[model samples]
Target: MGQGQQEKVATSLAGTVGEEISASLAPVDAELAARYPGDPGTRQPVHTVYVPGDLLTADTVRSWGDQALAALDEHAPDAASLAAVLGLSDDLAGPVHDRVRAKLRQEPVEDLRVDFEDGYGHRADAEEDHAAARAARLVARAYADGTAPPYTGIRMKCMEAAVRDRGIRTLDVFLTGLMEAGGLPGGLVLTLPKVTYPEQVTAMVRLLDAFERAHGLAPGRIGFEIQIETSQAILAADGTATVARMIQAAEGRATGLHYGTFDYSACLGVSAAHQASDHPAADHAKAVMQVAAAGTGVRVSDGSTNVLPVGPTAQVHAAWRLHYGLTRRALARAYYQGWDMHPGHLPTRYAAVFAFYREGLAAAAARLARYAERATGDVMDEPATAKALSGYLLRGLDCGALDLAEVTGLTGLDRAGLEAFATPRRGDLTASAG
Candidate 1:
């Protein structure tokens, strides 16, 4: 064959391969599409709160769900009572079952997260002693008995050296227990802590893979989240290589990378006696995580503010909550899902979430709309692409989403180029706006 003909044949083969790959990836694209189905203009934030049982009294724990109910009354009244879900410890259940029952009687959150750290902590033998199993059963029974809190599942110890040392075997044992005891709650979320490298996340994934094989569970049945706590994970030891490896490792199964501000500061030699969240080091650490997670579909969530100053007067409490809301929104705008440690933090959670969506939707929609019209075209109108890209810079700046330094980093179009892009053409570019 002539060289030209040979090139043609090679092109044909490459095209065929591309088609096959696209066909295979169709389902995956469909899943991602469905996963984030809202219009960019109306995207609601996914606010997943963490409730620690130790934070509340048993009487308070049982009576605890009222705040969630009140929240539902405000924003998503018909959306279901998800905020009230308990993170029941084995100890909490004995004291607060009835109080929890009263709330469950109203409407149960979709899933209840049982804190393994509270009960099991570093005890590898807790799995054998059946405390973990019993907790699962009690939660299951609560659901079965109509006093149940929707879905019941366990949150294993992610930070404890026991699981880290056992590696995948720890998860193996937990999965075994869940299976032998019938099944898990609605879902399993492995809360990873002190994650300094991507290898830690990869290890978790391998364990999930092994668990699937051992228990006959389908692939991708398990989901995990990394607590972006350690200084190494946030600020790389070897320039950007560590952060790159971290993002690469966290790509698939990671739903979101959560900020462990407390632990992160602690790891940085911040005194445990010091208030971790308020520390400047903590702010810088979270910002690092935020920047790392930018444009990555993996959602970023800020850690709890942790100042539960519920006081004497309603006026004083309201003022405190208002400040909390403003702070929460600021954090959310910085690209984070707000973490509600206390039920009282519900006000802040809703406020921040609403503000994020309200602002994010409008900003994304405006920028995307401009880009869609100007820069992103099929043919010779590539100059329009420059305009659209410039719009992103303006939108990011206007919305407080990105500062000038970050904007320059994102676009790489220097001041001169940006100025040229911003200047309008004489006639042809001017279009009618209805």
Candidate 2:
């Protein structure tokens, strides 16, 4: 046969050696792809309302948010500047107020963490255990009565070397009691504070496995979150990514990485006078958290504003202003979920969250409609963008920020389209299995 016109290049290896190079790269790609922590449920709540363990009851959450509502009633601002501070577009001021009131009355606390870590401080071990067990019973009762928050859980003490045993004991007692009374509620997960090592996460996983076995629940049924309080949780002693190692150690059980305001700042040796969520150090840590947790399905939560709305009664305006300002700042940074330390923070929380959804509702809906109309458009319509847009709508509907009619009317998307948008995205299947 006559040789075809071929342009030959110099080769380092003969024959099928080139094929071996491609073959070798496949296993490395597979190993790297295996490291990803898959997506979490999109319906995660926007805030966790923490109350002292002893003080939390189903009725407390159901009926406790009236003070903030009354404050809003009395302070009907006429000035545009004040309205701006509270995130009120003149068009939404009244409806937003009504929605805030309705949200407080209907579901004041979507995620309630009966705090024993900082909100409920150190006490005698036996007394702490007793409180936890008692709280567990109340939670179980709430579950039976359908009064529990949609997401409810407890925050045990720090699980460091100093108090690991005590923390474990309290966790065991509370969970055991909860299991005996009624199994855990939907979205129930433990919160482990002061995580500085991957071993802590692994130990927690092992402990949860033990509890599930003893209680006869399915393995991996108990999930927990780690608090990124110290800088060590962001960077390990040997200079590895602490967040990555911790999630890997969780063995598919870690759901969140909650920021701790005071503890984190104090760990950095910042004085109380300068300690705030907006501080540069805090921002750096939160940025680290966001970067580490992004695409890993691990939620990142901002810490609470300790500047609570407690008053000489005259200082209510100032307190609300500060709370609202801080909330707006956090929302700007994509930390939709945060902490509410008091009942009085509820009005501002709802007000800020509603404003966030309302402010962007127009743009998001238009973009979503435009993107949905065509498979590809000028705006990127990748799986992640679609997921986020759908999730934003779902959040509004679930939290009553927008009614079904409002969402459909605005987005030009029907119920089916919204539902399809909310479904988790499956990864690309074009790559061959290695």
Candidate 3:
């Protein structure tokens, strides 16, 4: 092998990467890279507050969810003051408290998961099912009373070989109790945690379909969420991504794929003390999850921050700080939703969420508006940019962090479009006719 300078052949080199490159991306492909929650699933909540089934009651919304509203109310002197407190931009001049009150009253727990798994723990089967039934009754009452959150559901234990039947039974009994008592809420979802195989998701879909058929519920009434906790769920022994397989197996009933930070980290042998949202392994898994769910009508949610906001007695600042940091991490990963174990996490959740949207509002809105008008600009905007832009705004609005007025100027979407942003593929911010 003679080492000599070869005659000058055209040498390839990396080109400049910036807003221009990113702008040209299609919404779907761009979402894969940016992790924006697309227009597939229901509007993601600011957070999913999971309460143990036993604690739920027909009137428990005030007790359980009010604490979160209180958390906001306490810090929020008014909309402007609260915005300043949260470091939100000046554009948020309206009354944030009114939004907080509406959220508290209407859908404080935009997505409420009655946990029979980790949050509830392995208790007596009878006791667990009874609690589940009770939770269903509460949901029914809430629905009848017009107090139901926009999205609500239960988190069953893992569908492992050891307890598959039990998980299925609990889910069935809960649904049975719910339907017989009053009726199912409009946004009923079931979360199957620690899923290790696609077969598990398929099994759940079958179970849900049967329930819908039997109870006169719509065919796809029982949307599902999978916990990507196990290593196998992310990658198979054959080195293939199983997350996609799981979604495919859901057969159109799949809605959410939630990451389990602590469980996943623990499985990888990380000490309990060290496991957190930003762990490299967790990041890689969530990235894989985001890519798998992109454009498939499936939403991705990050895991919870085990660090509760607490001090000697009801500490707020420390909890807020921790929640803000954890939430910021999740947002950076483009996870618009995650689990909330406590009420104190609410304030920080909104603060961080609002900040995230505000920080990018100017740029994103401008790009989106230009894309909608001419479909070309200083930054290339594809159809994908439309979805991405609309999704971003919808997530913010759905969570009460950004109002329509705050977004309209930048997005060039009217009130109708803003209202429809939360609906599935409705109110598409990009208009060809425009």
Top TM-score model: 2
Model 3, residue 155: C-alpha shift (Å)? 1.0
Candidate 2 residue-wise lDDT at 290: 88
Looking at model 2, residue 399 earns an lDDT score of 75
Global CA lDDT of candidate 1, please?
0.50
The list of candidate 3 runs beyond 4 A from truth reads: 1-38, 69-106, 216-218, 312-315, 375-377, 409-411, 415-434
lDDT of 1 by residue, 300-355 (tens): 66666656635443433554355455454445455434444555554434433333
Report backbone clashes per prediction.
4, 0, 2
Model 3: how far residue 295 lies from native, Å: 1.4
- Sort by lDDT, best first: what order? 2, 3, 1
TM-score for all models, in order of appearance: 0.56, 0.87, 0.80
Winning model by lDDT = 2
Clashing pairs in 2: none
Q: Per-residue lDDT tens digits of candidate 2, residues 1-434?
A: 35796777787767688789879999976655555535555577778988788777657776656665665556633334336556477987766777887887778888988888778887898789888998899888988888888888889877687778888888888888888896777768689999988898899998999888887889999898889999899888898879878878888788989999889999999999889889999998889888887767788899888887766555666777778788879988878788888777888788878877777787778777776775455676655576678778777777777778877887778867886776644453123212
Residue 9's lDDT within candidate 1 is 32
- State the lDDT of candidate 3 residue by residue for 212-305, as single tens digits: 8887877877788889998999999999999988988887777889998888998899888789888889889999999999767688998888
Give the C-alpha miss distance for residue 150 in model 2, angstroms.
0.7
Span of 10 residues, lowest total lDDT, candidate 2: 425-434
